[model samples]
Each structure stands twice: as C-alpha cells, then as structure tokens.
Target: MRWDGVHIAATGVWLPGRLSAEEAVAAGAYDADEHAANRIVSVAAAETEADGGPSAPEMAVRAARTALRRAGAAAERVSAVFHSHVWFQGADMWTPASYVADRTAGSGVPAFGLQQSCNAGVSSLELGARHLEVGGAVLLTTADRFSGPSFDRWRCERGLVYGDAGTALVLSSVGGFARLLSTSTAVDNSLEAISRPASPVADPSEARRPLDLSALADDYVRANGDPRRLTLRTAQVADASVRQALADADTRMEDVSRVVLNATGRSRMRWQLELQLGLNEKMSNWEFCSEAGHLGAGDHFAGLDDLVRSGQVLPGDRVLLVGGGTGYSCTSAVVEITESAHRPE
Candidate 1:
C-alpha cells in the first residue's frame, strides 16, 4: 500500500489550430521575430471543438487518450487520472475529473483534479507519484483553453502570450522515465495581489458548468493590477523551489543539466530566471511556451516535450521542470529521459 518510484512512461500533446510565430506577430498578438526567440517555437491556437460536450473533461479525455495510445497502454490500465484545467473552459459545475473518468475507455478508474493554476501539471504529477498505494499506471492530463473569454484579449503582454494546449503524461508503477525523486511547491500568498483579473465561474454550491467560449475576447483585456510585481514574486519562488526540490531529490544545482521554464515570453522568462532563479551564468530553454503562448496548465508538460525534442533530454540525462502559476505557486521536478521516451520521430 505504498507508492514507490513514480516514473513518466509517455507523453502526448494536442495543439490547437496551428499558427506560426510569424502568424502570431502578424496578427499583432505577439512578436515572432523578437530577439533571442527560441527557433523551436511554432504557435498553436487551440480551437474549441465539439467533443459531445463543451467541458474540460472532454478536452482532457482527448489528450489522455492520445497519450495512453502513444504509450501502448489501454485506458483500463490507468489506475488513476489527474486533470488540471486552469481557465474555465467549462462553467462551474462538477469537478471535471469525474467526466473524464466517465468518458475514459476504462470502465472503472479514479481521477482527481488540482487547482494549482500553471503549476497544476507538476502538482498532479507529484500526486500520482504518491498514489502508489493505488498500484496502477497513473495517467495525468493537463488541458486548458485560454482563448475563450479572452480570445482576442492579447493587448496585454500576458494575454498575448497565451495559447491553447493539452498534454498527457503516463507514470508507471514500477517507474519509467525519471523517478519523481521529490517535489516542492511554494506559495507566496502575500503576493497574491497580481492576477489576470478575471472572474472565475466555479460555484461551490453548484455543479461545474460546461465550457463556454463566448467571452474569449472579453477576459484578456481584464489585466491584473501589477504585472511587474507579480512577475518578480513569481521568479522569487521559482528560484527557491528549484533549490528545495533539488535538495529533496538529493541532487545539486551544479549537477542539473537541462531546465524547462514555461514562463510566457522570452524576455519575461529570461528576467524571471536571472533575477529569481539566479541563473545569470548560462542555460538552454526549449521555449515552447513563447511561440505557443502560455498553455495554462499544459505549460510544464508541453515544455518537457520541447526539452525532449530539442535533444536537451537524452536517455540518462537529468532535466529540471520549473512552474510559476498565477496563484504564485512555484513547483519543481527532476526528470531523467528514458530510451522508450526517446520515441522514433
């Protein structure tokens, strides 16, 4: 009745209607030709689709199925599911996890949802790693739709950098990729002053509503009070979380090789890490988030995909994941690339 080593077996991702960085810039939403842009970025605008329902569960199910299929694992093999949806794709109704389970091909599996905002992926990963007592492959899904309610609200730097995305990662009971050596999530609630400043539809008294995209363009203009302060505080905790998670994993900063930071833009990401993580020396960023914009909960998982694709993560290579969510939660995870994960491109 104990969770041993938690390993990532496979990863699956779904990008919205594809858009190039050039398109994003031309659209006046972002600048693709910006200096120091990661050559690896190709923006994706996740278009809302009819999946029998407009719900986070539907989006997550699509992603989960893809990831599990890539891993060659049946839905029934999934012992648990962790679903993270930051923005309200669906209105406040029931927890989206239940719908995912109901739609999951597997007849009887359990799923839980976490509200760590951008850090939801890593937080969910940590949860699956601990649910070893459940004793089965854990399929984690992170799916978010930032466009709805802010579809055209890109006038702001933060909103402009947002893109729609969904990612699925599977962890095996026997362990797969790199074991979840340890995890650290730090929250500076005092700095909760910053935010995208949108009203959430979650009604504690009512079942979660279905996904609504009518307000997509409206929410983006709702800028938070202090973007600068929020960014600064985010970097602060990211730095501390890195050190703490590294220590917990029994590893050292010097020993760490690759780092995946999913901050929205290159400039903001660079500033955050340097001023916060204290990495003024040298480092490589997969930078998937920039061109794609911020993919809500999918940032870290999607970033990991970039790391692997860019060859930053080869078998036996150690990679670090750092997440800075809106709630001011900082999370870090150490991952090792596995041969199986080095799937044929």
Candidate 2:
C-alpha cells in the first residue's frame, strides 16, 4: 500500500563475529564443493548458548536499544512491537515478542510475533507502516541464530548459508532520515509444498526434528513433477510486486539508487537480480549480503541499516526493498533517503 507520512526513524543491527567460508570448509563443517558453488565469503556466527552468547530475543533487545538510542525522543512514541523470526526462538510456546517488548518498548505496549518465514521482515515493515496511520510509532525487530544442535547453519539448506544477526527498524509519523513511499505484497500458496515435508508426521518429536530443506525440495519436485511452472510463477509474483511497489511510489526502477533482496546464494540471488528484477549485483546490496549470508527475516532491515550507516546512499536517493519466503509470499517496498546524516553513532 502507498504511504504518505510514514518514515523510518532509525535502524539498528547487532551482528556477531564472522566465520569465513574458508574456515568452515577447512574445519570440515562445510562442503568445499558447495562452498565453491555458493561463493559466500563469510557469515556472521554466534557463539553457542553454553558459551554465553545472547539468545535471539536478547540480541533483538540489544539492537532495539541501539535503535531507540538513535531515535532519541521518537522512541517514546512507540505503541507496539512486532518481532519476526524463522527458526526456534530459544524456547517453545513462550512469547519472544513480549520479552522483546518489555526490554525495549516496556510493558503495556501491544506486542506481536510474526512467523511469515523470511518475508516477515518486510511484512512487519508494512504492518508497522499501517499502524503509523493510527497515530503512533511502531517498532519492528527480526532476529535468528542459525547455530548447532538444532540447526546446522551450513548444511541445513542448499544455496544459502544461515547467519546470526538481529535487526530493528523504527517507523514514525513525526520525522526521520528516510520516507516510506510504498509497500506491496503478493502470494502463491500453491508453492507452499516446496518447503514442506512430503507427508505429515504423526509423532511430535519427529515433526520437530531438524530441517533438511534440500531434501524437502527434492521430495516436492518428485511428487509435484516438473518445477519449471512453479519457478515461473514465483518469478511472476515477485516481479509483479516490485513493479506495483514502484508504481505506487510514483517512481521507476531507474529512479532507485539501490535494491535490497533476500540474501540467498549466488544462483538464487542471480535469479532475482538478473532474471526477475533485470538488475545486476552492482545495482543491489549483494556485497553486504554475500558477507552476512541469509539473515532469515532480517536481511532487508540490516541491508538498509548498512547502506545508511556506510553512507552509500545519499539524500534524495530511492531504495527498493524486496523480500520472499518459503511460504511463497513476496513483499516489495520503496524508501527514499531524506537526509545525508544517517551514520551510526
């Protein structure tokens, strides 16, 4: 939907130490062949829970503090907190959104969790933008730690390496460095089986086992037959969303200074950048994504934060943000930098 007065007050990102792909390969944790094919230079790696690293929600709190500090007085107006995630958030059946809200926005503010897979970040942005229409600021946060016993960050998926990071964005109607022009979303629920197991598991324990996305995808292909039709549909909805978002913003692709997309591997990213968007890596935030890896639902916000902090974007520059998730949902947004002083504190 098109937005008028909504703005991105501030953004904050908390990234853990890095682990080079080469190191993972040398340590036998990563397949050398897969590393060569993916070309993901490095990924943010968090320490194990036993090593005292912050949990996913805790990292969100740290990022929220940074954003709240940057927002200054604007933070006081936040009326709700929306936390997004993909993997297990430290505990089952517990509300991570409430934990984040208490640590950041404090109690009494309505808190909600969005589990729309990787698209939740952009979905949260759209939701927050809508909430801003009702007269208050909204806090959007996404965090995920793709580490060990439960998930093998390196081997759990094909074409993507998971990362550990927390990202936050504050939206306000008052003032900010960037103006939110528009956001759009499209979905194709028929593609959901690509990420689902071949059959439902009756045992609760078996159902909660570690994910093998590569296997799941293979099974889906085998059961569904040729995947070319589904791939075409995916590209169609993604491209349509981007086109509609730009149109709603009253801008064109040429007007956008940068594009932020899902942080998948080279091949998948190429499909989005070259085939779907008709743009190359130079026109997008692929450099940041290549190093950080896929940060679950945090890619778009973290990429926007990096662009703003690094001063790669200047005043009046327009940025296009696109996100897609396994549930076969796509969301696109347009943001225009209204100031040149968005550097980190």
Q: Cα-based RMSD of the predictions, in order? A: 5.7, 1.2
Per-candidate TM equals 0.78, 0.97
Q: Which regions of candidate 1 fall more than 4 Å away from where they truly are?
A: 1-4, 20-42, 50-56, 72-76, 105-107, 148-153, 156-160, 196-233, 278-282, 309-311
Question: Could you tell me which 10 consecutive residues in candidate 1 have the lowest summed lDDT?
Answer: 208-217
Question: What is the alpha-carbon lDDT of model 2 when measured against the actual structure?
Answer: 0.90
Candidate 2 residue 87 C-alpha distance from true site, Å: 0.4
Query: Would you list the C-alpha lDDT of every candidate in the order shown?
Result: 0.65, 0.90
Q: Write the per-residue lDDT of candidate 1 for residues 1-345, one digit (tens) a residue.
A: 112466776677777665676555677655445523533255566545554333445667777777677665433467877788877657666777767766763646777888887788887777777775566678888877655444442433332355677778887765555556677878887644344224544654442222322233234324445545545666678777888888877777766777777645566566655766566424646345656766778877777766665566677777778876756787888876665355563
Instruction: Report residue 305 deviation for candidate 2 (angstroms).
Output: 0.3
